[model samples]
Target: MRIQTILALTDFSSPAEQALERAALLAAHHQARLQLLYIAERQEAKFCDPQARLEQRARQLSRRHQLTVQALPAAGDALAALHAAAAQADLLVMDNRLHGRWRWPTRALGLLARMLRTSPCPVLVVQGAARAPYVHVLVHAAGDEDSGGRLLHGAAAMHAGATVELFHVARPRRGLGLACGEAFARALRSRRQRVQQLAQPLQSVPHTRLRVSDAFETRRNRVGLATRGLDPARQLLVQQQGTRADLLVLAHAPRGVLRDLLQAGKAWRLLAGPEPVGCDVLLMPQRGPVTARPEAAGDAPARQSAVARRWTQAT
Candidate 1:
């Protein structure tokens, strides 16, 4: 998989700056275009000149690598500015926290999560400097043959810098104990691998790691996942040992009944305000391969439905 372009938003803080570095490295590795931007908040104008700051940051970023930076200037909400810029980007990169403030890291991550739902591209959350790009990528795709393959491709494309792993959580009809988590994972891996080749060629490469994980914990041979309804594997991105990922990519399967349920629940969870993830989520519609799905589009359809209801209510 090739990364055609990368978009990194910076607040001039250390964490944000580190995110820029990661973006630069990925862009350089893939020989893709890099766009570095800084949005100056109107109300908070210590470094208020958006154009000037953008230009300065762009120059600094360019010096660090052999690339041209696109500077964006916007008034009003800083988050809005970054969201607009992300409109044309393939992947959105930013830090989990801002510099100097010592604020909780999740504060910036929350905004990134909302932006992810609406972003046309996948979002990458860089939390401090980590040892790996992505050792194990967690996937939430479940379907027959065609339904889940598209999401797997998305995982590889977005995580071109790291190895790709396939993870699928199938809820038991009766509950949880009866399900075969390992066997299910193997089958999904076989199907997905047939659709797309792992980055490693000829044989597996130590330079990169790619494998599939089931909801079951490999350690105890027993399930770490909840028995049925609440296995985090079906919902949240839980931190796993020896399998940390620099980014998390998810493809929304609109047609699959199971995926649709999970996605709807996920949207409601985000809308209620704040989630427990420190990583960025790239929520793309399962329209097909290589097509970008932004969250703003989802809002339009939902908002239209609400308007239709209000009209019905007035009558």
Candidate 2:
């Protein structure tokens, strides 16, 4: 994907500073324009000139990095302001810890999760220090092949020299003894074979630097009826620790029932865990080629055209 504009939102915290530095690195790498956005708290606004300071920082960054930087400062609801500003951006970069919290049952949701839900483009949640030009990137493929392809494309676009590993979690079947784990392992292997086959042409054709390696680990709940609804997030966290990845890419909720469950449960847990994850996270939206189902024939043409447009740009 061609990234033309990157929007970096900041609350002026240490994490936000790291995000800004990372954003500058990305902008310099992709030759993309940079937009620095800050939403002022009521008390801070009363005491300081946020817009002027924001513009000053922008100018400083522009001069220091020799790249275009635009500073946008706004007051009131931060989420609303960010949503409005991110409309034209290809990537939204922000801190992992921000205002608001996720409320599942209620209408209110955490600012980060809520932004991921509605963002027009992919959202990159940057945590920890400013680690530029990621050396080791990991893309969690899970069960979605399309999402995996998109993740690989994204990784290639962002860091051409980074060692990219596509990791998959295979959940073993229950009540089948050793056979359950073996079966899941075989299935994961088959999936990896298919992914490799699909990627062969991509490596030769356009994404030459997007070569990706693959790995899978089996995760099964403890043997018991009480463990019926085991959480996958914990296992995922464990696997991430093993990889020690610099960047983790994941797809957001898709339309299918299984995907929705994964997103609503495991994905939510991962994002809302008690402790922060080690690496940066990129939450990709659900986007793919339109299906050929006859019931949706009316909209198929438009969807196909849109896909074509995207493919053209990627080419």
lDDT (0 to 1) per candidate: 0.53, 0.63
- RMSD of each candidate? 12.6, 10.8
Instruction: Give lDDT tens digits, candidate 1, residues 1-315.
Output: 346878887767677777788887777666778887764322355765656876777787777777766666656666777777788777778765322142233223345435644676666667656433554555554541345355566665544435655555434422223244544544555456553443234134334445666555442223333333435433335433235554555554333334433343453232232444455444555455443223343444444454345323322
Task: Give model 1's TM-score versus the native structure.
Answer: 0.63
Give one digit per residue, the lDDT tens place, for model 2 in 221-283: 222112443234654565567667788777775344344334454445565556445778888
Model 2 spans > 4 angstroms off: 40-47, 73-80, 98-108, 172-185, 188-193, 197-230, 254-268, 288-315
**Any idea how many clashes model 1 has?**
2
In model 1, which regions exceed 4 Å deviation?
40-45, 75-84, 97-110, 130-136, 143-148, 158-161, 174-209, 220-223, 226-229, 233-239, 252-315
**TM-scores, all models, native as reference:** 0.63, 0.72
Cα lDDT of model 2 overall? Answer: 0.63
